[model samples]
Target: MTTQLITPTQSAYAYPLLIKHLLNTPLIYSPDQEIVYRDCFRYDYKTLGKRIKQLASMLKAQGVKPGDTIAVMDWDSHRYLECFFAVPMMGAVLHTVNIRLTSEQLIYTINHAEDDIILVNEEFLPLLESVKDRFETVKKVIVLSDKGAIPASSIEFSGEYEALVSDAVPEYTFPDFDENTMATTFYTTGTTGLPKGVFFSHRQIVLHTYGVMAGLTAYKSQANISSADVYMPMTPMFHVHAWGMPYLMTLLGAKQVYPGRYEPETLLKLIVGEQVTYSHCVPTIMNMLITSPSIKDVDLKGWKVIIGGSALSKGLCKEALGHGINLFTGYGMSETCPILTLSNLKPHMLEWGEDEQVEIRCKTGLPIPEVQLEVVDVEGNPVAHDGQTPGEVVTRTPWLTQGYVKSGEQSEELWKDGWLHTGDIGVIDQEGYLRITDRLKDVIKTGGEWISSLELEDIISQHEAVNEVAVVGITDEKWGERPMAMVVLKEEFQGKISEKDIQEFCMTFVEKGQIPKYGVPGKIVLDAVIPKTSVGKISKKDIRGTYGENLN
Candidate 1:
């Protein structure tokens, strides 16, 4: 006898109902509080959302269709936040261009995405102007600035951002868009090669938002969060949607504080005065904040932080715990709707001691609900749950990007058998916790075994003298490839340490065989500070590009 498969009644049409029902709910809430933008102006969210809707109305009037892509270039600000919602909710795709990218790469992404209009901040206008002629698809330019006049050189836009919104009706209706309609497009950071685009639909973003709120994921509760909680995202808006916190904050109805350009002092002051209860940034940014001279005088007792965009160092995690701040680590990528796993404590782990709990919280974490994650070998076989054997991490989620935009190479490898290969080497514990051991490309192969550069970096960063560190493989004739440590020492101990000290420390972790003789970095390059990506992880790509070729 053949068995019949049954589908749940709610599974067939749950998305549209949720979207339409939640439309008029209090999606955004900001208290009557002051948010100092660059130590200057202050604005509330009621005003912010009004401006957002006005901008949405303006975009609608300008012939922006549902599928059109509107690219934005600006620092973190109320206006930037406005574009985050207005463009997407209006059914136009918001393409946040990475301002730190090279001019050529910037031109390449813009032309490739075919952005219909470019909304640029005044400070970035000159950079845009340098490649203005190269953007063949952009028909209009909307300047976002306090300056009164549009520059004479460029063609007149419909109007300046503020004026255009002021003239438009704020009450314009947001169209009923299908959940599957394109909502936003962001290009990958592309550590190795050209940037590729990833687009998210309304359904994906909405589901991602819900997944973020679930207690098993980030465990963000509106009850725990209030209108009083001030949010300052240290991550830039241009990178991986700032890990999607801006939208999440809006959805949670929290008061958001925007730091236009990240200055450690500015951020610290906002946290103290604004009583910032929650924030999100990468490990490097957290390092900068805690180590900065300004932090000594600041009171950060109630601050809760979420660390992502890269691995969180044990050193940084310890420092955060010391400050009486609640810190949690998560993992994701630009292709995975930016959040796949978050380190929330499991039910059984709650009985463990505080120290034991922190260790688990430091891992990459369990896959968020609706996301399925696996550690697979070279042939895609699932690795054991013993947590000792390492394998390539792969996943499937509703929010993950279908594939890179306009790129054909390795597309098959990226989404083979309907799962996204993360290229991260990791293992899953019996408790289902995932700990990323290394990036597949960055893993050191010596004596026919894999060495995790991430593991070594985490250990080296624990030294009091080390400020930041990155480990990359240097080609070796004998071992094929060996690990090299590029370090940035704490300011006070710059010349006081040697490469031998770092090597000696690694020897204590394991025997010579367990930690390969060649696994220790052959050379250590000392720098004033390690270069970092926009989201604040140490940029090993930059280090390898600068120094790897020199190694034999």
Candidate 2:
């Protein structure tokens, strides 16, 4: 059979899948819905639409043009949400700058991105001032402030965010362009070298919004979100478009509460005050919320959170469940538009109890709509779906970035053999659920046996005394490499729990045949806290650097 492509008539409108079109439904159906930014501001979707245009108008008046890179440095806020739409809708690339990056990394990303303008928050002005001198391409700065008064800064400001937006016309003609035009760019928080840039097109972002939306709401699951659900983002807006939820939520016109800075108390208050039903975050933020004193007063019932950026440990899952929180694991990286799979329960499995559900939710999960995934062996052959044999995960999806921006060598390596190679090792069950074992680089090879660092962390985290834990491989004289456990005890157990206590806890799982005896670390170091990546995943790279040596 021959493939036939149809051409549209001259009078027919060839609608491009642009970000501006996402506002269509919301503008008509949900114009009255509210969008809140901390305690300082609140506006309906009607105002949101106007403000989006106003922002675009302001940017244009300041010499911003199509294809220019506009970087934003701010906490998750309504202003950031406005930029998410207006900048890209205007045909300029939106660079969601990672505010948590180191000074050098920050400079590298801004300069490497060749950002033409920066919309920086009042709080980040000093940081921006320190690095602005080194920026090679930035031509202007616009300051964002909650108080509506721009803070005093050393750098020259084009204008204050609110004042400029208020002054600009509320209507601007956003030109139609090719759907494949670049819409967004961001740097991954890599541990080894400088941060690498990943970019996406308008088509990819729009399709990802649809794909993730269908996967989350089309099924019967505890983690499902809907138009009625109140939305908030615990994840930083700078990171993979906040896992692209802000776009999805805006399209649904869900009432969104933006917690400007993620203070534990403030986040808890917003949840209680605004009744935020759907949110997403890393496990570290989950732990922070569960341990917060304010959490005791907040009713988390009906609240749904998607845990990403790291493995969702069983301990964290159970803890969240105990607090009446519906939490599930989501899998993806910075390069895959940050959403590949969701651990939403299958309708039949919805009848299962909390314990059974936790197991499924902790898995990397079934691939989302349109996401093609496989666990492949070293030679790139698909591995058995027995849930025991592990292999590197590879995937193809409409939303996956074509390549890392400007890094052709790494881009070629990432898309080797036509499938984007995810460096994490994972396993698939007979039912098609993927369970990530560990990063390929983090797997501990000791005495000719491979051990999963993630498995060890999951086991150790189950201990009652363990507040947070990370497992990394330490170099050994005889074994070549061995697992080393780093633990932080609960506040009350700080003095009572010893390093030996954690080893014995792992032994319990060892005896149960859940893990091999060799998996138990010989060296267990109790500490006050474990270091984390900018995105809040356990920084095994940093941990290995500090304690990877064989002291004995």
Candidate 3:
């Protein structure tokens, strides 16, 4: 027998309740404790909160009414953190623009979201200047710059963010808002077409924060987090709101660090000097960090890291373990509040030996308590949890975006029957662990059978000479669509490894049918590094654009 619990609507829904833990908590515990800013500046929670409030007031004074969109263009910084709180708490929508996108795409997103204001970093001013005339809806430009000189430009209502916030009162009262009211709008990096928008409501974001903080999730204990744990998220703020780490850190009261423009050396220095305990980024960033010469002397033992944005390869996981880094994998997308599952060890795995447990922790873990995940076939039938059958991963959660902002293509299908359809193909074990096999679009079909490109890429990346690898399906007359491999070799091994040697290596693991008859790459184009999205995933779109015509 079960009892009915009281509903949230039965009680008064309050805005401050979302951040009640932070606002009501003691601000004096670490007055002098520092929140490092890109290894350049630092501030305590007291000072940080003051700036947040002042920024809130400044937004209010500038007529940034509730529900208005205020976009931010910057790497992770204290000012960006302030906007994280100020905009949402003030009942406005915070739009994070992906600076890595082409300038035209950036303008398209700004116009699509109807962003009324943009809080930009000094380093990104030139990009904004290039596209300012195209932003029809943007009314104001607040520059978050260290430079004192303000350039005289055609763009109106431009001023330094520091100057504007310094003059405003640091005590703006947050208004009451419906939990369902939209709080954030983060645009997706359109691999195929125009970028689509995913807007999250206040209630969704607040609940996501709690879900992440829950015992079963990645962040189990708040006490483990303090002002001392330095953070360097390789995940860009523009991508799924940096996997919601900015908000989680503020609630945990941890000192946050951001790598401005993501230099591996700069990140290594910050991590070693600041003693960064926790971080989240894609496997690409991890590859760069571990390979960087600057990190050779740094002590990474006991450092907690959550890898996402793409599948974490076993080879990369082993490299991290060798350095004594506590690394785990997470999986999510721009549409699902960015964190649907984490590879944290479950109760059953706790009894296993450390080595066995580490292996389990490397696969994408179970869903967060509130998240309901399933792997379904083309007919929408649930796949078996035997860990062999693969299906499209779908989910229903409180924090998922309602729908794409304007796209009418299968909006119903995306949230059909109340479950958000994630195009990832994956399998779940009896222990409730999820292991993503391949993206639906990236799966190679040979002789009417599916091959996991992700799995192939993982195997290829293990080659000592290979720095990066991307596998895509090319049109084939006999096999429907055959697998094609594009590789970027390490600097030292460049021009040394032949295509025949790589093909021979792949033949060891996969059967002839499982592997395409086409043994080698149709074409090999060498690059210094793989092109990546802002979130740091290998951009297959770029790869296809460069090689699609040749394949045809």
Candidate 4:
């Protein structure tokens, strides 16, 4: 078929879709929409544009060049937003360092990414100083202080962040580059080993942004985001670009509020003060907000939040809805540009009752546009979309990561048969919605039955006394593995609720056919809190390691 080839005329020109181009429409249209950083400062999109250019100028002045990696460790702030644009726009890769990682893993990610320089928030200076000697590529340290003057540090400062931007020329041009140029890189919070690096190109990010916008708006969604939407990111910016909401908001020129740090009181204040209309986070944050005394008297009506990074429990969903907050589920991971599915209701489905709506909204969701998703058996055959046939969810999308950086074996495993294996076991409904049952490793195979730990967690979290829950499979001789639950009780319910009560609760679900009898955990260990991964998902692997041994 290629034997006859023809070239296009010179009249045709190709325009690459780089990250810098995302700022063009906003600068032209909504130049005055404010980007607020808590109560500390506020700037319009015009100034955001200017600051981004200045930031680029400053980085260039500091020896950053195309393809160099500039890392940032800070809270979700205006400065982070500027770097989100400026660093990538200048053709230098942005490495959003995860402060939640341990000192060792933190050093590993920075070294693996080959970051040439790091911009550290004052609070993290001690972390930098502890590992600066072990850094493989770091050459400069720039301090970022939101408060008063930064204290003296053992590690010498290359330049203060604010000063660098202030001193630089604001007129530096961002040259266009190939759309496939690597734009940003970050490490995934893996369970079994050190973090894995995943990166995206300029074209992938832009497409993901538009795809998310389309997915949110293409249906009847209370959480639909647009220019009128006031945006706040509850997810950490260091994690999957805060599910990439920052770029979508900027592209739409929406009013943005960056809560410097996530405190319950501070978040409530900003939600009320800024009228934050839309946000996204894991279920833990939702639990915190709903239970916090600060939000008790606050009217959270009209606040739409998309829950991801973990499953949304029905109890949590009902609680958020009771407060008149529009809550739903979104499904993605650090690998798929962090978003491939969102559980927005169809137009006809909107008339369904609230219970049905919550049920639908909590599923893994339908795939967004340009995303090809499938539930496949071990042999790579497609499963029947009957809502009961469980299989691994594999997908093909333009925005998915090329592969794990420098890990060829894992990368090959990720893209076997030309589809990106998600390592997620799920079932697709006849209506085309995906319900993720469990991670491939987290599923309990007991007495020749597969039990979903997420299912158990969801069922137990409905108890009035339960605050949070995690279910993990513990090793056993008779059964290959048995489920054990670690629970966190509400303060008032502590020491009052017994393990038997939870067991009896599970019995009720078994009776109702919600879960099988074997799916119930043999024990429920009550605690003050459940440990979480760096990105806020419940750390089931840690729980298994702690309790799964010597359970005789």
Candidate 5:
């Protein structure tokens, strides 16, 4: 029999799940590991820890206090990583401002967050100054520059980032507080009216870090990351903490390289120079890199990449595989603290042929531990996991965002029925792999049947002359909605391929029973490039607004 044991007095060392604790594991094991910043500078993990303290000291010297919010705008760099920890650890909220947003939307989010301090990159000085007069709560602006020069700007300079931190002490006592304290905030990039603010607490972030680490290390595949691997993020740091990889990697004591800008040449060079082994990006960014003239000579054989933000098409996967890139799909959204599933194969399935594995790799993938994922009907009933039946995907996980910042109505809709509604339609197979069919709002309906726009696009992507394609439901007086194709042909086949060619090619899939006959598009509009969202997702919402008539 076991009994409770307690000291007569407090233990004096009770631990709170603070963000600073994440640095403990790395500080102990790999204090000397390197974190590179492009090709510009490099520092050891020991220095990184010291810099984090310096950053906190600097913030505190600037009067940043508990419950205040601080905003940052910069490319993916070591400085952002420091703020990810320093601001939150000090009890101030870190608002990762999405610099890619429209100027008006950016202003709205800034006001909505009520940030007291803004740590902005030199490049965004003009952008920040343009709306500085309209900000209601901004108290100071700290400018960051890689070359150590603060540019002249209209926004009164509070100080330069490097200069202020240089004079601050390298030590500060981070106080203890409730684990549920708000740690960070960022806005979702939906094409809806305004960006909705989502916030996470210290406890939630710590648990999420553990969950992501478990998902990556527990899997036995090419994407199974370890401390030995060099990490780089192709996604923007302002976007969900670059899909939360920076924290996950640093905790594992992995070497990280931060590319200042996303120019294809720079990325390819850093990949080769730093010997980066693991990376994640949206399909559009990967597409841009793969098609770049510079990537042809690099050795991508052991490069493990997780493609997210949108569905990965057959054409893109084939190209990546041809270059020996270990490519697969991952699924998550801003509301989920970014990662929910990764497409890693089962142990027994490892021997399967490459083509067979690629099929599974391209699916939406299986959920990580602590993520209870379910596909459900409109009434909230669970759907069968029979692979053919489609339903909306919902999930329950501890790390998920509690709700939108202060919008009770939207927050209620987000947590309806005690499950986080993902608004994504998916199908789960017998082996427990989930494949997203389409967004609930993007599915096409015609002739009394539902057709998956993703399925049609994937099929069309395999066509010889196709480069990219988007399928949408266009208005039809008789059918209610009809599938229309916005096709982007390969450069070699620009005008050589016609609308009939695409429609006819789609029917071949129908003849093979791969897709329904009605799934074929009625009209195909050739385009040079398909419009995309800021995160590289197909701009279906914007496309519908422009081309879709009464196609509700």
Candidate 6:
């Protein structure tokens, strides 16, 4: 059968899906809607539109041409949001510099991306000063400061961010270009070696924003977001564009508050003062917010948060529920534009009690709109959807990165067998819930059996004394590998519970036939904290590197 095709009028306008169009709805519908940055700055969408033009003019005056890379090193602020649109709309690539990477990795990304201009926060001046000589392609630097003060530095300054925007012509028009033009590039440290760069087109980003919007609002779950809800982002703007929420929220014309630098007190204050109703962050940030002394003083009853970047432990889900913060899991990686699934409950599941819902909330979740996900065995065949058998997760999505920038070999491996290999071990239930068990590299292979580190971590996290926990396999002579736990206890219980106590707690689970007896950690190391990646996931890689050899 042949498919029918339709032809449009010769004079009909062929609109392209560009980032600039995202601005139009907001400017027309919510022109006066406020976009706030900490306690200092606040402005409306109309002004934001003008400022975007001003920023583009400023960059143009500084010789930023289409295809040039413009990098930003500021915290999550209105300025960063401005760049998110203005740079791409101008046909240049936006490089969101990961401020958390080590100095070497940071310099490598800046150089690797061939950034032509960098809008850097004033606080990071010393970092650039110490390594400016190493930068290979950075041609200019614009200072971003809350006080509008441009401090002295060894590197030649292009200008202060606001001053340049204020002086540049605001009437310059944004030209239309191919929707497939490269719009943004950011390095992801999800892989080994140096960071791998992921590039996305304007069309891909637009579709992704729509995909996330539909996924969040279409469901009847507690985490649904609407235009009436106040939105703030707890994730760093540099990480997958804060899971691409800025674009989604902007398109909705929702009120936005950007908390600069993520100070606990400031985050809590903004939430209460602005009545922030919707936000997203890693589990670590949620843990920090709940454990903070200021949290008790603030009211968080109606706030809705989505926890991603790592698994949402059932213990954390229960703890957050007690504080009246609505929480759920979102799953993805940098390679996937960072949003493949969200743990939004189905209509029927909403009738279940909180305890029953927590189980669903902690699963990796159902795939978001336009995402085709599957758990495949070693041979690339689909696994049973019984939720017991584990397999590697792979996906096909409109927004997945086409390839890693400039690295042919790595890109091939990433898209092997025509699917984007997630390198994650996961399972799908009969009801379509996907639960990630472990990273393929992090899974423990011990004495002819497999033990999931995530499962062990979940069990340990439920203990009353446990504040944070990470379980990794250490080399063992008899078992080939054995589980080891590095734990951090709550302040009140730091001195009360010992390592032996945690081992006994896991043994109780073993007695219930929850985990196998051998699954208990052979050694438990209580510490002040567990190591975390730049995006706040538990750093099991670092843990194993530090203790893998000596612990056994």
| Overall lDDT per candidate, in order of appearance | 0.77, 0.92, 0.77, 0.90, 0.89, 0.92
**After superposition, candidate 3 runs with Cα above 4 Å error:** 1-22, 26-32, 215-228, 347-358, 408-410, 511-529, 549-552
Compute each candidate's TM-score over C-alphas.
0.91, 0.98, 0.91, 0.98, 0.97, 0.98
Candidate 4 local lDDT, residue 11: 92
RMSD of each: 3.4, 1.1, 3.3, 1.4, 2.2, 1.2
Q: How would you encode candidate 3's per-residue C-alpha lDDT over 1-552 as one tens digit per residue?
A: 899976677567544444433444425564454667775667787888788889998988888998899999987777777787789888889998888778988899999999999888777777888998787898888877765456665566567888888888989777665777788897787667878888988778878887876732345421134445766677877787788877776666666776667898788788887778888888888989888887778888868888888888767777788888888888888899878888877555557765686667667877876889999998888999998899999998888888999876657768876689998899999878899988888887766978788877777777777777888777776767667787778779877888776777787655645455453445444443567776678888776666565354
Give the clashing residue pairs of candidate 2, or none. none
Q: What TM-score does structure 3 among the candidates reach? A: 0.91
| Candidate 6 per-residue lDDT over residues 1-552, each given as its tens digit | 899887999999889999998888888889999999998899999889999999999999999999999999999999999999999999999999998888888898999999999999999988877778998888999999888988988988988999889999987689999999998999988646999999999998999999999999997877789889999999999999899999999999999999999999999999999999999999899989888998888879999999998888988999999989989999988888879999999998889999999999999999999999999999999999999989999999989999999999999999999999999999999999999999999899888799999999999999988878889999998899999999988889978898889999999999999899899999998964688998888888888888878454
Candidate 1 ranges with C-alpha deviation above 4 Å: 1-23, 27-45, 147-157, 216-228, 347-355, 511-514, 549-552
Residue 523 shift from truth in candidate 3, angstroms: 6.4
Which 10-residue window of candidate 1 scores lowest in summed lDDT? 17-26
On lDDT, the stronger of 1 and 5 is 5
Count clashes in each candidate, considering only residues at least 3 apart in sequence or on different chains.
0, 0, 1, 0, 0, 0
Model 2 ranges with Cα > 4 A deviation: none
Better by lDDT, candidate 4 or 2 = 2
Native-to-model Cα distance after best TM-score fit, residue 480 in candidate 6, in Å: 0.7
